[model samples]
Target chain A: MREVAALAGVSVKTVSRVVNQEAGVSSAVRERVSSAVSRLDYRPNLAASNLRRAGARTGLIGALVQDLSNSFSAGVLRALEDTARAHRTGVLATSLDEGVERERELVHDLVTRRVDGLVIMPASTRHDYLVSELRTGTPAVFVDRPPRGVDADSVVVDNASGARSGTEHLLARGHRRIAGLFHLTQIVTVQHRIDGFRSAHEAFGLVPDPRLVVTDISSAEEATRVVDRLLALDDPPTAIFAARNLLATGAVRSLAQHGLRRSVALVGFDDFPLADLLDPPLTVVRQDVARIGRTVGELIFQRIDGDTSPPRHVVIEPTLVVRGSGEIRPTA
Target chain B: MREVAALAGVSVKTVSRVVNQEAGVSSAVRERVSSAVSRLDYRPNLAASNLRRAGARTGLIGALVQDLSNSFSAGVLRALEDTARAHRTGVLATSLDEGVERERELVHDLVTRRVDGLVIMPASTRHDYLVSELRTGTPAVFVDRPPRGVDADSVVVDNASGARSGTEHLLARGHRRIAGLFHLTQIVTVQHRIDGFRSAHEAFGLVPDPRLVVTDISSAEEATRVVDRLLALDDPPTAIFAARNLLATGAVRSLAQHGLRRSVALVGFDDFPLADLLDPPLTVVRQDVARIGRTVGELIFQRIDGDTSPPRHVVIEPTLVVRGSGEIRPTA
Candidate 1:
């Protein structure tokens, strides 16, 4: 502190004020002090200071999601940020990219930085690894997926019910031959959605063709290829149920190329931007993403505010949006 | 360490290995130790430890963008994350939402947390405030925009040229009256794009009507409203040049609603996901977002690795993607 004050030609009190980000210091003086502090590589031991000040917080939260590039994850993050900012807190967000090891690593990193709380959309099947962190009083709220092996506050869309409704919509339109395009089956949400797809078919005393049910469709391009192959089959599906946004996008592309967009009925699980503006207009089972994000934010903040209540599990219901694509009747 | 070992019934060496994330510790043992550490609130002073070891890093970087929900910013963040992971680093990503004060505050927050480097798409018009941080040896790379009032590594798309090309394309299609839907003029890129729009008109000895060139459109819905109002005029535009993705989306919606989708030509500045799949397809001036991200990542990493060379400014040229929309002929 003395060195910074001396170098900046300011009083030690002024330097302290600048360093503490307190008001009443001129911009020039603050800049000078900051420059001096930087040149000397002087970092105040914030952790030590926070420890000394009772109830002092780092005012930083950690958020780990599946992918930052995906609209679903991005929307969740944005909402969390909005909530955090209201409390004068900052969020440290990172993507796990479906890597369990990466999730653990990032959780560890964030904890080391002494973040006040955590909001995680786990890539791991079991969150037994987080047991230690939770025990240490690091409040956590899971989003998009529920936590397994450890109890935690969670906000998730009713994937199975949503998928069932979308599938049932096509089935109600008299389409028995429907193709199911899905993401990785290992994901709990995906498995639930698959179950819903099966249950919807069972309601009509029918079963989905095993050949038409494709899993592990990772990218839009891959989904397009899968749909193209399905179309080439001896018995092409008359309707398609895409379990994810990218999968739906691929299906749209393939259907467009095959010139069967108007003929084949399609219902996607998740709604995306401009879904209603497409040629035939896409029908989807739309998750209330904003509400989900807001719910997760509120839950996480509540936990951080020392709520010792039992873990709350929230399931937001999705609604099926009817448009031109899903309303298409089977030509066959 | 002693208390943690005693609580977990593990040797000090075992606890050390677990804490350092070194190999050879059993999962059960590691879990026990971690739990004990959490219960005891035993935090290893990583900052002190890092200081003891030469060239030690916290293995974290900070990224601040305008909006994470926007595809452009999200895509850049994802690419940066990919590159960061290759070097076994975690990125702490945040959204500024075009708030200048928020940018300064987050930068201060990240600095206090001791991030090794920064990737910023600044919301501030001038970054003279970052001088002290730079002097303190924080490597930063500006993305999507250039740094003002301070010299730093920057990677930006050629906004003017891209906009010029798009406007010229519409002009070449014999559209004399073209409406320009733009974002906030305060943004440097927006200003550059507006200049390009004017220059394109000038090439044909024409000047755009100030009434047709609308600015300060903050949302797609707003753009739609603006386009609708413009369409109701006696001298309606035959073509539309949207300066951003969201603005273009708004124009597309309004055009569709007005039953003029095929009649009015439209070209957007930034290409978005599913642009090719839209009705009549969206023509755009596409920026190589991945490449820009990679370049920023490379430059920041190089600086972190002690590269003290003069700050490099890399401007990536945007490409005009001629699709169905931009090729539409004017009927007026």
Candidate 2:
């Protein structure tokens, strides 16, 4: 800092102000400080600067996950841990269980601890408070789903494309009556997947039959009931496409109970543990969770580094991994 | 603090000195400060005290996990996350991959971040550096396995008891020959389970028969080969105990492939997803992962509270969850 100040022909306080990006510094002084900083290869001692204030870096990055029990969330969290470790920062992980008050409390506590940044999966529809917090120079990025009612960096799966491709694969295999099972979460990601599924059905010149669609089943058990009803239909679908792993588990169980594994072709979104090891291996669209997490971590770090141009959202596409279930020729 | 000093009939500096437990303070003065603290319900804010110094709560806890992919670590990490969230603290998690340099770097990074406490599942044979760090008033506790060459609070499962119970259950079902399949982690927990299995066989006046024991198999594929070799033997064991979930997966696959699911009995140490829905439900010795995690969290928090008492070790007992697979009565 002293070398920069000397080279810039300015007082130490002026150089400090310029480096910290304080508003009072004149444009000319800022330019001089920037040039001098470049010339000296001066890297500001961030820890020292933070120590001058009560709120220090805590060297922690707060990660607010939606649910820990979900395999997707766990995988993403692990990836984030790896990224944070590389930056010499540690993660402070909290699960909100989709509660608004819990999210608020978590955010406030993390702020009080002065974490370096946050990677949050917001559950609530109203994210204006988060927007305000971001506007005040706090770096944050949303994952799994985009931030609603706010502008920020986001990392999400190309759910619509994934669903379309999955449904199209079923259609290409001569299956017209395909049931789509999904959870009732009001997140934009789920909406995109549903839209994609609809698009694929329309492309095949088929109506999006309401009877073949199931929603509002919050758990695998309820999903099992939905599957039971679908298979019990007079013209039961020749195939099923579960929109998530838990629903897929339910579908698999339903098929196994009725000994229909040899008849119905099953395709699921999101690959899960033991998916391939099943009696008739499951075919599903697998998301690159680790890559998505790593991308979000990098974006958040860039955002924190004053890379403030515009909010960016990156969507990685999912790939279909065919094992056996999806490749089954429907014997309808 | 001023009020406390007044109530204790001491100067504010004297109160501070007593609170910090500086050696210069007299016992009488310490007693007075203690009484004043109790009366005022005053909790000294370490953050405030460390304004010009280094030690402070940092409001962060570090968790060092051996392998995130392992079910045991995942369960414990989830439980620790829940407990840490309730305490309004954040947990920084990292996977060691059992690398000594990685562990050292992780420990250094966590200490540099000034985390209030640590919950570690050691990766190396010894971590004396961690011991030195803890000795400087940094609180730490071990989980799954204790740190080598140091004494500290540790929380682990009763591996021996669980293994012994499982082995005895198999013996009681009139199975004369039993095989043990273990992973290649070379961890103490694994050794304990092997010992317990041996003890059970010895109690029944049966030899362990080296041919029946298979080691150095970590993944499902490797375990499948080991199980195949055991099953191919002229005098194959009537039953097997897989030491972990992946091994259990292998055992299930091998048993199913050989059409031996109904004839051969098997019990696994850790539970896997969808174990109950297999051809025959798997029996497992289930560890209380959540309980063990909560215990470790509490121990670390207590240490962070400046409890300089002797180190304590906690062992949580495992339960035998009997299912269809282990109850297959061997026929003569």
Pick the lDDT winner: 1
Q: Which candidate is the best by TM-score?
A: 1
Residues A1-332 of candidate 1 have per-residue lDDT tens digits of 78889999999889879988999999999999999987897766554457556777777888999888888898888888888878877777788889999899888777766678999999998999888777667889999999998999999999999999999999999998999999998899999999999999999999999999999998999999999999999989999999999999999999999999899999998888999889889999998888888888899888888898999999999999998899999985
lDDT for B54 (candidate 2): 59
> A73-154, model 2: which lDDT tens digit per residue?
7778778888887777777777777788988777766654567788998777668867545543568898877887888888
Task: Tell me each candidate's i-RMS in Å.
Answer: 2.8, 7.3
- Best-performing candidate as measured by DockQ: 1
DockQ of 1: 0.47
Model 1 segments more than 4 A misplaced: A4-48, A51-56, B4-56
Off by over 4 Å in 2: A1-49, A53-58, A172-177, A228-238, A257-263, A304-306, A327-332, B1-56, B127-129, B172-177, B228-238, B250-265, B302-311, B327-332
